[model samples]
Target: MRYSDCGGLLKISFLGKPRIEFNQQDITKEFGSKAIALLCLLMINRNGYCNREKILAYLWPNSNDKSAKYNLRFNLWTIKKNVGLDGNGNEFLCVDRERCSINKDYEYQCDIALIKDLLDDNIDDLEDLETMRHFFNGELLEGYYFKECNEFNEVIIYERNLFEVAKVKLLLRLAKQYENRGDLDSCLNTLEETVKFAPYDEDIVLKIMEIYELQDKNSLAVIYYNTYKNRLVNLLGTQPSKKLTAKFYELSKRPSKGVKLGKTDFDTNNKQRICIKTKCINGIKYFWMASVIKSLLEVEGLQLEDYLTDTQLRDLSYIQPDIANSLGETSARTEVPDVRIAVAFVKLIEKISDSIRLKIIILAENEMDDFSRSLYEYLQDMRLHVDLISE
Candidate 1:
């Protein structure tokens, strides 16, 4: 468990990829597939005795019992011969007729850096912090798998969960340490890395945005906000919370264009309903519009099933006949989408509003495609409220 300053070393790295070294020299290549798998089984058990039958079933499951036992013996020999010795010239493995295990006295080191440091509360150690600042080399045992070994893989899944929990904790601690030092650059870098895996974490997102604001990087802050909002809508069938939306406006300095949802009226007269945001884009004519429709449908009270056919409801978020589909094309097809499609969309909104109040934000008016621009104007003409926000 301890890799630090142990001269009697069987140093093994379990993070990123599993590798073995002896006396500061790599001996990973000396072991064959079954040998390494057998070794991992023992190590995962933390030097406990592994029954011979269990080892045989895990390592050579397809072989007959006699052949499996023979294979286990051969791999045990391979492991013993190659794992090398300690500073006091002691053997690392202890084998008997029925079970095998590692010698607890030997310095057996495996790199579960995140897991180790977290348990020991070692993040504040300056050297360890620097080492972990960019420690996303890969996940534990990256790309290492035994296709035929389901049981071993199950243990790996259980352990991977433990590693991931520790990893997130480690990154949060690392980012906090950087921020405490007023090292905004390192803090931002670490936060961004954390966001890659923990995108749904609102608190972490807030931290990143707060740092950006401190550094007066508001443009990136706005971009990040919109990107995250889009992700939430697309992936979670939800939008960012009001807190995140308010933060966007505060950081973006675009509050005037935002209508507080509570004060907004959803009447038939439709004052200022087309919330045009002049920032951030795609296909079915203007593919981005479907995402807009999806955003509207995602509201809690909107029953898309009531408004659309089963097929349309099923593919609503992704498939847009207005912009991307060609199944209904005919010889009389217009050079552009028939205005009826736009009318259908407006009517759909009308129905949705009658059932439940809604507010829509069309991001990036300046960058929006021409057809989508026309749709916004049409919505405006239909007497919908247009809360336009732009650079």
Candidate 2:
């Protein structure tokens, strides 16, 4: 008898997947596929109704009217039993001599119905538009198929195609709304989602590249163009459009100034060398820094090595001894340069003992939480010169 936040309403979902719920509890497992199929048919029809003849024709075209009617009756009974009835023994379905339909008084919500309602409202309502966009998790009953029913399959396919088109339109509209408001980030996010649904869509790809260019992320623009081109060639065996190719060529021609970390001159062939250690080598800032550092090292005939591989860093017990030997066992465990990584790094330095004055670089200083900052301070206390760079 417990009710969900959605109240006591029966909720049915046919978009992307199929499910039936009452008061937030899934009851779909109680019904057979045929029973669910029948329910879906009735729910989709106008007025939530379908005639017995048409239902039989669509569901069992191979069978005669008598057999089809018998099967339909059994499915209806199963559906009713699964859905249950009111105190008056009236089922959720309203049944006439030759037709079956959902009872008008039944409290229920359907995803498709909600989508239709949203579409009927003013598209200017950004909230409603976003809601509509999210409601389309995927195509209608995406993977569900009715056996021996080509008509039913056709219906599902048609509805899926229609809904997919609608979803793309909705995304484009939402992207435009974001663009108009000068929210490039939101616009890019919307377009990214849209591209998933239409990877080969030149217009969307162009817009995404344009946004990246506007944001002064020319490298990202070039990367995206290359990825799209590879996908096009692999998937469609075609090349990018002339305009897109031209834009990509233009972006590629832009000189790479490389990432700048403070006012340090990397061009000098001084004896000083630097190694960067990061907790996680992900994210745009980390990537840029790594690229810049790599380029600088190549120019200066130097190499940066990882102190510990991901697996080695996971074992705290093994690293504790090495860290204690370097920073003293009495050092507060709260120190920066993670003891595990730092210890491994010190080992590398000792192994490569030479006359190379090495400096340590830590990318993304501002992003580090308290623990990371403590590690940085610990390294400084050890008299190891550490350059903390922030994006």
Q: For model 2, how does the per-residue alpha-carbon lDDT over 180-202 read when each residue is reduced to its tens digit?
A: 88899899989988997888999
Cα lDDT tens digits for candidate 1, 1-391 = 2224433567776667668888778998988767877777787665368888888777777888889888888888888888777876778888898888877777655656334643466546545656554444567667877778788778778877776766677788888888888999989988877787788999988888889789776545655665576568767999888888888767655222344432222233322222222223642355445656645443322234445444333233233532222223322223333455565566666554442334555455566766667776776676533333444
For each candidate in the order shown, give its overall lDDT on alpha carbons.
0.63, 0.63
The C-alpha stretches of model 1 lying farther than 4 A from their native spots are: 1-8, 117-122, 132-136, 254-391
lDDT of 1: 0.63
lDDT of 2: 0.63
Which 10-residue window of candidate 1 scores lowest in summed lDDT? 270-279
Query: Model 2, 255: alpha-carbon shift in Å?
Result: 3.3
lDDT for 28 in candidate 1 is: 88
Residue 161 in candidate 1, Cα distance off native in Å: 3.6
The candidate 2 region of ten consecutive residues with least summed lDDT is 262-271
In angstroms, the error of model 1 at 198 is 1.6
